[model samples]
Target: MSFDPAQALRLAHDTLDIEAAAVLGLKRRLGDDFARAVALVLGITGRVVVMGMGKSGHVGRKIAATLASTGTPAFFVHPAEASHGDLGMIQPRDAVLAVSNSGEVDELTVLLPLVKRLGVPLLAMTGHPQSTLARHADVVLDSGVEKEACPLNLAPTASTTAQLALGDALAVALLDARGFRAEDFARSHPGGALGRRLLTRVSDIMRSGDAVPRVLPGADFSHLMREMTRKGLGASAIADADGRVLGIFTDGDLRRLVETGRDLRALTAREVMHAAPRTIAADALAAEAAEVMEKHRITVLLATGADGRLTGALNSNDLMRAKVI
Candidate 1:
C-alpha cells in the first residue's frame, strides 16, 4: 500500500548509522575488564565454553568457531541446555564467555550459580554492566549500543553486530598472543579450499608412474603429440633413458612449429621441445603449483624429484578439479 522510495532510503541510512555507532562506540569501551577476560581465557588449560540464548547464541557459536580455528580451542554450549545437564560441559579448567544484551538471560542466569560453584571464571558480554549476569561475572565485556537498527528499536540488530565484532576482536587478540600461524588455521580447516592450498602437497595431487606423459629425445613430433593426447596434460615430458627430465614439448610448441612452417612429420622431439621448462617438485604444496602455473603462463607442469628426474605431472585442469584453484 505504501511504496515510497524516500522512506526506504531513509530506513537504509538509519540502519547504517545505528550499526556504525555501535562499532565506533566499541573503541571507547575497551578497558581493564577486556584485558582481564583475555588473560583468563589464555591461561585456561581447558577449552573456552561460549554460552548465549537466541541471537546471542548465534554470535556465541561463531565466536567459539573463530577461537577454535585460531588455536584458542573453544566450543558453544547453549544456556537453555546448560540449565539441564549441559553445564557439565564446563570443566574446572575451562573459562566461560556468556553473551546477553540485557545481561540477564534467564537460561544463562540459571546456570550462573552452578558455573560459579565449579570455580570456572565467567566472562560476560553484555550492554548493561549493572545487570545481574554482569555483577556475577568475573570479567564483563561492554557491548553497549546507543540504539537498535530496527525503526521501532525493538529488534536485536546493532547489538548483535557489536557482540559479533567484539567476539572477533577477542579471538584475534588471543590468536596473536599465542603466535597462531596460517598453518594452524589450515589444520582446523582441512576440508576447505584454503586448507587444501596450504596443507596439500603436489605429491598428493600429481599424476605419477604410468599416468605421466613422457618421450625420449629421439621421439618424433608425432610420438610427442600422441603422448600429450594420451596423457591429457596438453604436453609431454622429454626424458632420458634413466627418466631424468631433459626438456618439455607442449601444445604451444606444436603451434609455434606449425606457424614456422616446420614439417611436424619430419620434426624430432628435441627440435621442438622447450630446453628449460618451468617445473615444480612433487613435494611442493598444491598452492605453489598454482603459483607456478601463473608464473609460467602454462596449463601443465612437470613434477620433478630432488635428483632432477621426472616423478609426476600436473595441469591447471587437475588443480581446478582438485579445488586447489
Candidate 2:
C-alpha cells in the first residue's frame, strides 16, 4: 500500500469542514430554548451537575470546567457512577446538565425519575428532542448534527464538536449575565499562567529589602557598579537617606557614559541616573507592570509605595519568571 499525502490532506479538510458546519448550524437553531437553559442554570443556587457516558462524558468534563472557571460552579459526574452512590452528590437546589447525543442512554434516563423526584432542574443537551432524557428535561438544548465527521459516521466527531460548541455558548452567556470578570476567572485558575497575569501583584514577585539594587545619590561609580553587580538586576536605584527613589541608573546609562569616554571613577550616582524614572505601585497587577515596562521601552521598574518610596524592584526577566509576561 502506498501512502498518499494529498489524499490524507483532502480527508482532513473534509472532516474539519463537516465539524465547522455542524457548529454553525447550532447558531441558527439557538433561540428561546437556549435562553431558557441559561436562565435555569443561572437561577439555580447550587452547582451545575453535568452527567454523561463515554465520549459524551469526556465532553461533559470540559463543559463542567469551562462553566466552573467562568463563574458557574459545576462538576462532572459519570452517569454510571451516579446510579451507584454519586447520586447523593446532587442536591435539590442544583441544576443537572445531562449530555447524550441520542438522549437514550439507559444509565442517564434511568436516573431522570429520581432527578425529577428531588425537584432538581434538568437541562438536556441531546440530538433527539423526543428522546427520553429530553422529554423529562425542564429545558432542552439541541446539539444535533446532520452527520459525523467520521468516514463511516460511527465515531462521535461532528456531534461531539456541536455539543462542545453549544456548551461553550451556554457558559459564555452565563458568564456575561453574571458579569464574570477576568479577576474572578483568575481566582478560579490561580495555578495557571492566566491567573499569574491577572491576580499576581507587583509586590508578590518583586525583589525587596536589601536585594533591591540601590545607591545613595553621592555614591561613587565603584559603589554603583558593585550594587548593580551584587543585585544582578542590570540597574540601581538612586535613593535618598529616607529610601525615597530619586532616579534610576541602568546598564544603558552606563553604555552612554562610556560612549563619551568620561572618567568612570569621577562620576557620582546622581550625576548619571535618569531622574523620575517610571515607577509602578506596589499593589498594582504584574500584568500592569509588564505593560508599563513595555511602554517605556525599559527592562526594569522600581516598585513604589503610596508615599513614593522604593519598596521593590523587578524587570522583564522577573515578570517572565513569574509567568506574568
Candidate 3:
C-alpha cells in the first residue's frame, strides 16, 4: 500500500484510457436524438437555458458558453437556482438542456414539469435515458459511459468527460448548421486573442494627427529631422500640400544618406525620399498590416483614407500593443 511510481503511472494511463473510451462511446450512440436536439436549439427564438447540478452543472456551464459564443444563444441556469425564483429566467421561447448522469437528481426532476409547462423544448443529456428527466424531455442525448476513471468508480470522471465531449460536439454541429464565421465568434470573444486579430481595424490602432511623423515636401532637412525625432516613429512621410503622401524617409534612408558623405543639412524632404511607399487603408484590418510588414520585412506602414491622403501611421509596435499580431 506504500507509494509506487510505476503503479501511479499505470493509474494515470488507465484514467486517460477510460475517459477517451467514454467520449468515443458517445459517437456510436449519436444519431437522430442529437440531430433533434440541434434542431430544437435552432428553432428556438430565445437562448438555450442549460440546467444541471454538481459536476454535471460545471459541464453545462461550459456548454452554454460554447453555444453562446459559436452563434447559438445560450446561458447556464443551475437547477438548484431554477427551483427558486431563477426559474423566471427561462422564457417560453428558450430551449432547456438539462444535464445529469443519472437523469433523476431530485432538484432537477422536481422542476421538469414546470419547465414543460413553460411550453419550451427540453433536451436531456443523461446516461440513464429511462430516468424521469429524459422521460419528460422533448429529446434525449445519451451521455452514457461503461465505467468511471476513478478507482472506486464513484466519482463523475468518465461520465463528465463524455458530457463535455458531447457538449462540444453539439456546439460544433450547431456552428456549422448556422454557418457561423470566425468574425461572428470574434465579436463574442472580444477580449481573447482571436478577437483582437479579427475585430481590430487599422484606424483603431494607428497614430493620427500630430502623432504621425510627416513633413511637407518643401520642408528643409532640419525640419524633416525634427518631425521624425518629435514623432519617434523611426520614419517620416513626405506629403504634398493637399495631405497626399508623396514618399517616405526612414532611419535606413538616413543611414545610407550619411554613408554617401553628402551634407545632410542642404537636402529638402522631397530630394531624398523614397517615392510610392507602401501604404494601408485606414479602414483595413490591423491583421492585414501585420502580414504586409512581415512579407516586406519592414516595420512602419502609413495609413491613408478614401481620398488617398495619409490619415495615420502604424508599425509592428502598434499591432503588438493591440495584440493583433
Candidate 4:
C-alpha cells in the first residue's frame, strides 16, 4: 500500500487540536483544592517531593524543576524507588505531590502507607477523585481530561499534558504567593545564560585600575592615542588636570579627524575629544550599562566614580564575554 502523506499530516493536526482542547478544558477544573495546595507548599519550611510513575514521572520531574527555580524548593522521586528505600528523601516537614492518571500505579499504592505514616501532606493529581490515591491525599487536583489525543485511546498523551499544565499552575500560584523575583530565579539557575545576564554586576566584570585608559584633557592627541593603544580599549577618557573626567575620544574621532585632514601629531586632545560623552556609574548594574550602550548605538562607554573621576571603561565586547547580552 502506498503511504498517504496528506492523511498523515491531517492526523498529526488532529492530534494537536485534540490535545490543545484538552488542556484548555483544565482551566475550569481548577478549584479550591488548587488554592489549598499552594497554601500548603508556601507554609512549609522544607522542600517539596514530587513522585510519579512512567509518563507521569517525566512530567513530575519538570514540575519539580520549575517549582525549585521559581521560589519553592522541590525535587522529584521515583515512585518505585520510594517503595524500595527512596522514601527516606521525604522529610516530615515536606509536602508530597503525586501524579497518576488512573491513581492506581502499583508503586504509588505501595508507598501510600509510608506517606501517611510520615505525616507529610499529600497532594494528588488524577482522573478519578474516587480512586484510592485521591482518597489518601489531603488535596486532590483533578487533571481529568475528557479523552486522549491518541486515536487508539491507549497512549498517555493529552492526560500527561493536562497534568503538566496543572503542575505549572501550582508553581505559578506559589511563585506569586512568595513574591518571587528575577534575582531569586537567577540564583537557582546560575549556570544558565539568563543567570549570567541578571546576576553579574558591572564591578564583577569591569576592567579597573591600570587596565583603565585615561588621559588629561590638555594632553595632546598623540598621547591620548598612545593610551588608547596601550590599554587596548579603542578609547581613552579625557580627564581634568586633577584627574576628573572631561569626556572621551575614540577611533571614530580619529577617522573624522583624518577625513578633515587635521594632522594628529599637531592637534591637541581638546580639539578632537567629544565633550560630555555619556557615562555610567561604576556601581550601576552591567545589564543597565548594556541598555545604555544599545540606546546610544555606541560601542564604548566610560565608567566613573561618584566624584566624576575616571574609574574604568567598558566596550560592547566585555558585555558579550560576560554573557550580559
Task: Name the best candidate (by lDDT).
Answer: 2
Candidate 1, after superposition: displacement of residue 202 in Å? 1.4
Write model 3 residue lDDT over 142-199, tens digit each, in one string: 9999999999999999999999999999999999999999999999999999999899
By lDDT, rank the candidates, best first: 2, 3, 1, 4
RMSD (CA, Å), candidate 2 to true, equals 1.8
Q: List the residue pairs that clash in candidate 3.
A: none
lDDT of 4 by residue, 238-321 (tens): 888766778889888888879987667887777788999999888888898999999999988888888887788899999999
lDDT of 1 by residue, 226-268 (tens): 8989988888999999988889988887777789886679888
* Residues 68-133 of candidate 2: C-alpha lDDT, one tens digit per residue: 999999999999999999999999999999999999999999999999999999999999999999
**Model 2: how far is 33 from its true place, Å?**
0.8
- Ten residues in a row with the worst lDDT in model 1? 255-264
Q: Is candidate 3 or candidate 4 better by TM-score?
A: 3
What Cα-based lDDT does every candidate model obtain?
A: 0.91, 0.96, 0.94, 0.88
> Could you tell me which 10 consecutive residues in candidate 3 have the lowest summed lDDT?
76-85
lDDT of 1: 0.91
Q: What clash pairs does model 2 have?
A: none
**What global local distance difference test value does model 4 have?**
0.88
RMSD after CA superposition, every candidate = 1.7, 1.8, 1.2, 1.4
